[model samples]
Target chain A: MTEEQTRENGDAPRGKEKSEQILDAVKERRNRQRESAAAEEKTVNLVVFILDGDFYGFYGEEIKEILPYEPVTFVPGCPDDLLGIINVRGDIESVVNLHRMMGISPGEPTRDTRIVIASAEGIRSGILVDGVEDVLDVPQSEIKRPLATLDRSIREFAVGGETLYNEKYVTILDVGKIFSKIVH
Target chain B: MQTQTLFLLLFTLKGIRFGVDMEGICGMEPLSRTSEREIPIGWFHEVLSLEISRSDYQSPMVLYLQNAKSHFGVIIESPEEVNRQIDLENIRPLPKLMEQLCRISPVWGAALTSGKGEKGIVLLTDLFRWRDLSLKIESKTATVAPPAVS
Candidate 1:
């Protein structure tokens, strides 16, 4: 039977099936390319870190480097959040106590403590964190705006949050707000 | 890296620790044998309006401060150690809530966490500005618009 007659008669198109397989492969690849482009536009790269046993994320583009905790010179006449300035490869950069800035109880710096150097609004500062977690892609659809129940200080610093599959809410910090407080 | 340091004189008042920039301090001495009433430190006299104890009157120390054309002395409880190399950057500026509670600009900021237990937040004050504001307030009260003629 001809290919059209065979399909209408509930029989597979035996001879045309090879060409159909090729067409299906091309269509599937095109669909994959479109979906990949969409995902590339919709997802953001984040450098996640642990703070007080909670996960938080920062834009990967804003982060310069994550270094081991260094002894920062204690300076007076600045905000408590501005812990002190650290010398990072001959560059004097302010190290901030993120815990204090978020109004969380300050903890002792442990071996896992790290300083996340972030640049925003032309200002470079280091954020002291408990531990460096993972670098991952978070879909935009997963992130939600800061909620009313969040602390006002924290809300000011956080751009959005995302609940992961394990039910952990990762708060994304706004680099502009984090650096704005130090500029002055 | 070597950072700029702020020299401060730490002292206690009514169980609270406080600090002031030592830049303006010209001299300091024990208040023993000195008459508190005649003490030239106007700010010290002003603090008397608060609930000061009799023991506080006994061991107070006088700090003579000089800034430009103005000079004054203040009596605080015993003078603690002089922090000669406090990093100026580590000082914590007062938050809006604290500013509202204090209602004074001379109260500069607090010290960062020192990891000590219950060490309490030390209130840092600007010696020069505190004295200047005190003088302005004194001048305002001194210039009593002559009692309205009934």
Candidate 2:
């Protein structure tokens, strides 16, 4: 607001104290805006999903799309984690089981099962999950380092950080790291 | 845009459908009529190490492959598609990690079919690339002489 708008009276008041008060108000507003802009850069958008009764999330930008259980053709000699390949329209995409990678019991494919097609670091594939929870815009500050007691296998590549989402603790996954493991 | 028709010889094995390039298939015959001395026959699943339910082939058919001196033929199950054609663009390469597996497996690519009652990905197998393995264990007792000069 202009100096006149911050005046004690609707008309311009003539006083040194009054003018000083108006200047202070304007500076406070500017400081607030700067703070929020800094925080915005740290905010991250995530897509949360459920796997083996645990909550997990991936960066929103890494996920390309989510599709229902499609016909997956089992390929011989493929690793256990590589469930199969599916026909996405005319494109062929490999379906991966996250439960196997996370060391969790694999759940049977059901109506709630979803395939999240994600791409990172020039690698792309469809990750099969038990269910999808929700998408959230979480602040980076809320994301905490993984538990010290966590297994060395999972914490090394999969875990990005953990945070609370909808009163549930979600383990953020590092998409690029996960893709690299499969590619390598 | 120019559209190319991909001719494939499709067949079923252990309930999964597979296709091969028709340009390489020379002829097809019933298993009983195929003579071992003339051409060597190999099981499709065993040659490429494809996993499937083991079952007796009561009426297995042999597909003779061209461009091989051994005159190799592959035994396949029912629903043999001799000259089925689909769009060439429909065939896509195996994604990422799976592409590396193709180095050991015969299935290097796949195609999607939307035809009525036959809608799914058809795995493309290349038997011609692994022709040398066709004659393995064909003659148990005696080894036949090599093919004569044509």
Candidate 3:
């Protein structure tokens, strides 16, 4: 509020107190606006990878590490998407075949094959990828909702995607949906 | 409530990719090791009638469908991959008209698969119903078959 708005029909001491209160209120509003602008300007970090030759990405905060592919023990009766479990240090983590989950044909593991250890909502698992591309800071505006052409099943969990100037398309997956699939 | 995730074995048959539930799948064997000639005459005809070219019988891969009682083999080009775990929520059921038109349509659903610069459709098979149909074919063949030649 302006100084004129803060003026009151009162004695000098009381008017000073009212002016001081108005000043504090104005400062608070200015601080809130600055915080909101900062929040909007912040960029999102993503970890990008290739699965069955298609580019995919996950929030960088959801990833724990990127490790080379290791031998996994076959677990009977487990879902086919789960290759098996691997020993990540002292911890055993389930490795998921993202290619198969995406309905893509599985490709042979090569030198570029890597396991992405990702965690979301307290659930952690490893996803097998053809290769780890890079970590990028994508502006929020660059990300758009998935198109109508995308299957409802996949589009439900796809948090939109970003297109690079080079025309490379990257779909960002919803990590929570990725880890929440029930194992048969 | 049940978790909608399912384990499926993905394979390509007649140039189109299809997925079948892994629950009823006993295992996959190379056709060279277990030749199509070994299959009984009754079940063999049923397989041939399903539009799969007789030539495909010589394919390299054989997926065995099994329940508690018996097993039947399906000849496919190859076992492309086993999707050990897949969330059923990501699978879309075929349109009502498509299902109604193809009464024996082995595929109950489909999903989109992306590749280099293009996308393709992947059909998902209904494992339980598919096995039931196979058994029905076997039983029908047994009941209607003519006497074996001496």
On TM-score, the candidate that comes out on top is 2
Cα lDDT tens digits, model 2, B15-121, are 56788888877888776665555555566777655675335444677777878354566777754566789787788888886866887666778888878677888
Tell me the DockQ of each model, to 2 decimals.
0.03, 0.58, 0.02
The sequence of per-residue lDDT tens digits that candidate 3 reaches over residues B36-141 is: 4433223222432444544564445656667776555655566666864666645555432233422564555655455467244456665545555666665432
> Per-residue lDDT for A47-150 in model 3, tens only?
88887776778899999999998766433224566775555654556677777667778888899999999887676788889999889888777777655676
Local lDDT at B148 for model 2: 25
Where in model 1 is the C-alpha error above 4 Å?
A1-41, A146-148, A163-167, A182-184, B1-150
Q: Candidate 3: where is the Cα deviation over 4 Å?
A: A1-36, A151-153, A160-166, B1-150
Candidate 2 Cα misplacement greater than 4 A, ranges:
A1-29, A32-41, B1-3, B53-58, B68-70, B132-150
lDDT of 1 by residue, A1-184 (tens): 5778888999865665777889999999999999998976698889989989888889899998999987765433345667755555544566778888787886888999999988887667788999988888877777776556877878878876754634777888987787676554
Model 2 scores a TM of 0.81
Residue lDDT tens for model 2, A115-183 = 999998887899998888898788888898877776676675655598887787787888787767776
- Tell me the lDDT of model 3 at B122: 57
TM-score: model 2, chain A: 0.79
Task: Give the per-residue Cα lDDT of candidate 1 at A128.
Answer: 92
How displaced is residue A64 in candidate 2, in Å?
1.1
Cα error, candidate 1, residue B16 (Å):
23
